[model samples]
Target chain A: MPGNPAVPVAGNRFCIVGGASLVGSATAGELLDHGAAEVVLFDNFAFGSDAAIAHLKDHPRLRLVRGDVMRMANLLRATEGMAGVLQLAAYMTLSMDRDPWGGLDVNIRGVQNALEACRANKVQKVVFASSNAVYGYGPGVSGDLVEGTPFHSVGAPPAAILYGASKIIGEQLCRDAFRKWGQDYVILRYSTVYGERQHYRAANALYIIETYDAVRRGEAPKVFGDGSETKHFVYVGDLARANRMAFESQATDVAVNTSGPAPITTLELVRLVTELAGGGPEPIFVGNEPGKVRLTSGGAFRIAHEEAFRAIGWTPEVDMKEGLRRLIAWRESNEGRAAA
Target chain B: MPGNPAVPVAGNRFCIVGGASLVGSATAGELLDHGAAEVVLFDNFAFGSDAAIAHLKDHPRLRLVRGDVMRMANLLRATEGMAGVLQLAAYMTLSMDRDPWGGLDVNIRGVQNALEACRANKVQKVVFASSNAVYGYGPGVSGDLVEGTPFHSVGAPPAAILYGASKIIGEQLCRDAFRKWGQDYVILRYSTVYGERQHYRAANALYIIETYDAVRRGEAPKVFGDGSETKHFVYVGDLARANRMAFESQATDVAVNTSGPAPITTLELVRLVTELAGGGPEPIFVGNEPGKVRLTSGGAFRIAHEEAFRAIGWTPEVDMKEGLRRLIAWRESNEGRAAA
Candidate 1:
């Protein structure tokens, strides 16, 4: 099994490149719970906060490395002796719009550094975090978005296109690494991760917490456009499992979608969040906020996770309702309160 | 005329980033011929060479500056007192496939550096050389490729996607600059450029020179696949004219395609080149070259340049046969002889 790219989690070492955030912390906890010998949370904490990883800060099996991916030397050190490395650091559309210079540095150079690190360290498997934004945004993105869906960037904003393009570049870098050096990698195109330790960063998933917060404050939850625009999000824990499965399974040089069970309209999502937060005033349908980089899909679209199951034998176990319940419960918890 | 975006060509200074290559030299000649006050050719000569710009090296109005686009300080100094800047620095798919790290650096960050330089110097206009590759490759790319065509990256190689995505990023960076600081820019999505000073770079345009060289050497020209693949090429001089018009016209915050009069099939191109090189044996159809990154379009596609004429009053004047003749003539010239 020299180049057979499969590594089980039990008693193995794992490194999450953009660790200290929602999916990173969740994946770390999941790996640690599954008897991982060591889980290194490597992060610079630029967008990542200590609060996100506070719950698992003292775990004996976990270690945190403060480093920047822009530095190849840092990555060369961080990924050493790890069985698997999950690269999760990137700037979302909003942040990309704010500071593209930093965004491109972290997204493109960051992924390259992590991959180079994996190559140098001879890591067994890599689970790269690609996004469904690779399908791109705007009117051309609709219907069942499979792995073969072409990147549709027409009519999209610059930052959104940049973020999507960056992800595309990152995914290809993984593919390139695999082809060049036999470095096995699985690119999981996660759709809008939302759950516990949810940071208000992503353009799509922020709507959930924003809606919940509005309801909590006795204000009407605002839905941009007709609220019929579809959002397919994968729960962070489910995505965590997908990341683990990608490493453990015999899947290599493949990319697949890791979306939630079903798509949700904005109105449905707002209502669900309102209901989860003990019900509030009626929702308001409003125009898009000025100067906000909102990712708008033209028609109802479902990101098919069938390919993920086909590729890695993993499926989303957390539905949005159940996922929302957990997120709301965590929001009410002391850690969430402290983090807020 | 204060704050007016258009910069008259007669006496205005212009800077061409990555201006030691084919398009850069052609555009420099065009600018100098139009009575430009000064034309600064700033380049690092990484992919560029002195042979490419040897013909115009001693032009009094043209100043050659060795500078890397990754360095903002270099760009700032280069753009000082410039009326306009034409950013021609980029890595195509073949080079991108080989060294993505360098490609991404020069394509994405290089563009940002150029824009920042233009911003710092209060440059009136910028002409960014984007590519029709923004329409992407493979089956998804066919028919009339207008500016509104969605980027189709499915089934394409990693380097091609990365290159296209990088150009998309560069174009968006131009748009972002326009929005952020009212920096006027015209993104010219040039199709495969071919003419005098044709280099070994550019995957598509290589076919013409390769075929011509093979025929001249009394060998059978090699054609990949059935040679029915489409190639839309704009002469370098025409593209240079388009770049000048982009700066001279009042058009701003616009992107348009600058393609040749029409596209030609690979077979037609090979035959034409063979005839131009003094006829040889017919092209030998062959499978894809092993380990070579060939950008294969599934169907016949034409990159429309109507918008270029509408936007900046520019059109491709030289047809393919004429352009290839010029390219072959240059290849037979003393400078080309020295370079070869």
Candidate 2:
């Protein structure tokens, strides 16, 4: 708290934990493009696919470290001499439903290990990748979801609640580290992220890819329920910029939403995806999937990102149309289809 | 879901994980009095004390098993042949703040281990001791904290949020087990407990013991803030009975609050404790103790236990005054002083 908390990108070294996936790869490129001296991508390649980071593998300034967050030595060694660490390793709801033990271990203890490594190595700042899932799911989740919104889990599935609570615990672990050891940090509560390098693991963002695939196959895109449920998302590039801004800003010990400019309904999203994918038949409405873990909200809500501007002077630059268009183009590309 | 979910105590066997403590001892006695064939008390005694369960040690129906919840083998062996298992092994906010590494392991993974053990053993019912902290802290938490109340963490200390979120994860693990393996469970969201065998570890319940100690030393009891902060507590005996009722009822995969008849403000609670501990000086208003973990609520709230009545035909019979009177009586007795 005594001196400036911001770490300049140029000539500085950074490490991205779980940096082989969608947001991680984007943020790594953003940091590298900004003249970072060295950018290390630490991943165990468990959920992280090699195809996701193939573009960056040959970059001279980028180094990929094969490591697991559950192991302290991996984090300690990878984080040594780093100026900042972007902790992005986690299991979203789908993977959590399949394996909660591994998810909780990575989400909770993984964050703890990352922070401890930062402390041990004297890393200047940590920009932790949190999620708007911290606001939780259910009827109680509606309206503007600011950083202070309580987690609502009344009717949410177990895996969804587990994922949200684990994120909440992860954020608090950062706060605990800050209070206990003055480990500077900024928590970015990202909404569903979409765009180039979009992954299929996220429950909400999967709708985009699934709808695109259906449209490509000349099948009608499917929308669950009335399709009036709100879905807020940020472009991966915008999130990448936000992660960079978090390190460049003087913000520390704060958490803020980093959502897109506005919200979209499921119906609108499907229609948009259909149109963007060239052409498609009329969409069909369907009931909930029987055994699939789906995240449902009681009412429409928007994850506000004004606090991100105030805390780190960052804002979403990509609209849904533009972001989804990028995602479609990527899906048509060899790299994206290979990842798919 | 096929057979009777209820496991009657008269001819059944039970295991209490983290059993050598306040609620554990009280619930152990309740089961024995109800004619349980055998009751196993499993504990690591890390935070649990020997004096806490001394009175129940010699009972012919009770047996103590030294074990750690972290070790799956310990839980697997202890939970074998058990009809019902009450998981009370956890770190409150104070202990969580001290050692989060251990706390997360015990609270999150420990619950997973217990549920896994129960599933492997084909245990009929699991009574998980979740806390009203799942409702969370800060201003968003106020008025009628029913079973569905969302968790609010704005302006709360990190330790408190971590503790609350850990409990949320624990409950979801129970739900996850029920969904995955048909593991029958009843999650009781207990409020702060105060009665004959009270402990000093809980942030809110420690108020009673601290006030009693101050009054006993002829010093004015201390009240933090304006002392209007609400504190809702269930009697330890009532919780014990609720545990029994939970197992005896046919309810499965249900969570309900188990609070007292009502809530009391800090000032009223301090004064009541002072009165119960013989005549004492006027209570002193003081600011929060620096560097100490204190759970401060944003506004007045009551943890409604009405759902418990509906779910398991259980209701709190003890109010603040009576619960405090029993605590006072115990404090003056030989066993309580010896533990103190």
Candidate 3:
């Protein structure tokens, strides 16, 4: 609390680790628009893509650096002279299910390497991107999920639990750094992100794209279960603003949820997507996919974001309907289609 | 279920990774006593000490192999020709708090290397020594803690969370191996272990030793809080048998709790230790240790071991009173003093 924890965006250099993805690119743009002196996009491009970041690749203030978080040397080089560091590199449940070894390396060790580099270079503040997956998936995961919710993994798959536990570890690693070296940091637990520049990665967000694709192909969108399942998502742009605010604000050594304006049922989500894609046939109810990692909660749950308002003076601005409109419009655009 | 999952003890070879400490030495003795063809004690002696295994060092059937779990070649060579491998190498909360780098490498990477070696060496069965710490610590941790209990980590120290998360990862890694290949394994989520050959390492069990030592020096045993915090612990010998039966059973791709007959409050535990050590002054109520990683629960919680009985056909036989008696008697002996 003593040495001015807030590192303002204007006239300051910031680095976005894993900076080619949806949240990363949007956050890079947000920082740049706020008159940041320089914004370094550091990524190994393992999961990041050129098309996702192509729009700002040539921006004057944005510089792209190819680096892997697995290597300390790469991070040490990438974080040099950075006022703030945004750690957005991680493997979601689907990717973790496929390759846990690489996922663990990136999610666990990658965060460690990034934080170590930040500490070594004396970065003023770090904004770590965690997830609601830390609440875990299973029967015990229901009701209002606050920052104090314990992880529930009774019937969840191994990869999902691994992803959640890895995030928990990452958050704790930041806490450890704070206790050890007084490193100022804020952990933003982003829910499933959607909207412009949406990737085909996250298991939860796949419903929107899959539904839109099915509707566009003149087919009925598939709705698994009765679709009463809850899905909380924060718009990528909203999360971008949260990242910028996290650094610009005086909040440090705290974690809070940055969910969207509200939560929506799966049925509502699918219908919203279909309507946004210019109306389609009625949905077809289906059972669970045999091998895919799908997160199922016990009942209706809301990941409240009021803490974000108090902690970082930020609140989500986009609702599902408005967010879906932007997403469908982006999908129809030239860049979004090419990126897809 | 298509093939025999059980790897019987008689006339079988086994490797105990980290088999130089309290549980490791006891387990080695258990396996040898049951007519194992050969037992390899593989350890780097980082946490494993010479005195812990001094009693069994002269046994011809028990071979002491100096190695590190971080080294794949070491694990591979040590596990070769073994029918089963018991992975017991890990850093507890205390050690994890001290050196998180070495701890994370050992806990995460060490387990990975051991499992990889088991797969490479064609080890028939693996009995992974998980802990009740997987249920985690804090306000959310109370009531009956069963095998499927979700992890509760609110208000817990960073090291404790890291330790618990690492074990969760370890258990999931075993499940992942089982799904990827047919790696038959049983994960025994052992609670705070105490009995003969008890080390001064574990946070919870430290009270027992500290109490006994205090009694020996004519001082009062110190108790934290109102001394009603619940502590469920498994006797080491019973855990040793549980490990043996875990390999010898048909259980595979399963995890269960291996707690004691019941839980004891801090005051009761201190009183029991005092009585067992031939009576002493009343326990001194003390405040929480400032920088210590003492695991205090929200309320009294009992880690149920019913699932372990169903999975491995084993249950806690030695009650805490009896287990502490043996521990106190050992403390009065030459071997225990030398080990201490």
Candidate 4:
């Protein structure tokens, strides 16, 4: 084991696995801003798009590598001289419902591949991007969700359960790697992430974009199930800081929740998005759409990030209103329009 | 979709994935005894042993096909014309701890491959061998463990959590196949299985065998903790019956527990094993063995099988005492001795 688990950012090289992503891009920028020698963005563009990282394309200290997490050679080469690695490559519930085969492959095997590569490359520390989905869905998922909360899957969609269980397996893989080899690592169980570069792939986070789009097109935003379902989402920028803090902290072999400042119900979120989208029509209440994979909680719940503050000296700084405002502003911007 | 999901065992063909092991061999025998025209035992023998299936090697109705679940071609060829496929291929906590890469491949990808092969072959029904591990291990795992119980993994070992989460994914994969292709399937969430042909692979079940071996050599059986941790185990013969019923019944798209009549604490189990082995020295109480993987459940719990009876009209017939007696008899027999 190293004398200290912390891997200082200054003058150190960092590799972001699945780097061409909302969180990945933001973390790369954060690392580069902190005086990192080089920030390598490795992604295969499977779900990633060039537009997501277009702003960082010209940075002298930033480099993009076209790579796939399923391919170990790419990861091995990417992390050869890196001091830290942030694994953000995974498939959310929406895509998992469409293609479970690929989702399981990328989510489970992908993490193992990245960890093995980091071990072989002697990467100083790894910051794995886990999800609060580890707590799971349905009736059993209510109340304050701490890091020790059990996974609840009763009444949940198979795809949603698969996605959650896959994340659980990924986190365990990191823990297993640490036990076998003295690998210093921290797992940030990020809640739904929504921000400037947010994609329409995550089941929970997609609701914000959809509500905004409906309001933008002069239609009432739709809220399912009386809009009482709780959703907690972290801004991409806050998560980016969490990733950087994980690398700089002495915490190792630990996992904690990294959620937004607070959770909002569907009705509240729809109302907030409609107001932010230039005072649109009243929100419409609706039942679940058949054939749609939706994640629902039985009761109101909050994913507490107190453990995160203790683990990496970090906490979510962006509130939903501010985060949503930034997201809407980005949607109207040229870069976001081009990406859409 | 079939008008009726039931697939009669009489005069029909069946394939058992991972069929050279304990549950596989026993289920194959049960199917053959029920007048099935042919029974195919497909396995790679990586964990499966020839001794486990030695008794049925000469049976004209039983055909052993050497195959690996990781290979789709092997599964496709083995599952051809099969009315039902029993997917038993998996790596338990011990093996998963040793090699997580191989374990994840066999547990997750292996289940997907079997389901896909069943789809391609137009198989009538599938009986997936899921485990009670889906409920997970930890302090939160107490009381009656029914089908709807959520998974608890807060304080468990990484390998244990990995094994449980893998089973959860496997069960969801079966559910996904059913929804996508109208595949008829029944999931049997078996607790620890022990019986005549018991193997030394399962973490919980190995305790019984280990205790017996120690007692036989005049050594005191070792009990970790106060020996009050609950362990619920189903007899292999009873599980075989459940597998056969799952195929013969009309139940599909449902998962239920198949456990013994009741649960027994660790100390009670050790005492029973010692008595079953013709009385031995008192068990020695000790702390956890260093460098060893141990699955510790927090509170007393019983895995309920009422749902299994409701779903498949099956319940465990042999209690642990009777089951242990049969296992002891087999161990002293010529066949069991040679196999060991």
TM-score of chain B of each: 0.99, 0.98, 0.98, 0.99
Question: For this target, which candidate reaches the highest DockQ against the unseen true structure?
Answer: 2
Candidate 4 C-alpha lDDT tens digits along B1-340: 3647999999999999999999999999999999999999999999999899999989999999999999999999999999999999999999999988899999999999999999999999999999999999888889999999989998899999999999999999989988998899999999999998888888899989899999999999999999999999999999999999999999999999999999999999999999889999999999999988999888899999999989899989999899999999999999878766
**CAPRI tier for the interface of model 4:** high
Q: In model 3, which runs have C-alpha deviations exceeding 4 angstroms? A: none
Ranking by DockQ: 2, 4, 3, 1
Count of clashes, each model = 0, 0, 0, 0
Docking class of 3: high
- What lDDT score goes with residue A117 in model 2? 96
| Model 3 interface root-mean-square deviation | 0.8
lDDT: worst 10-residue window of model 1 chain A: A147-156
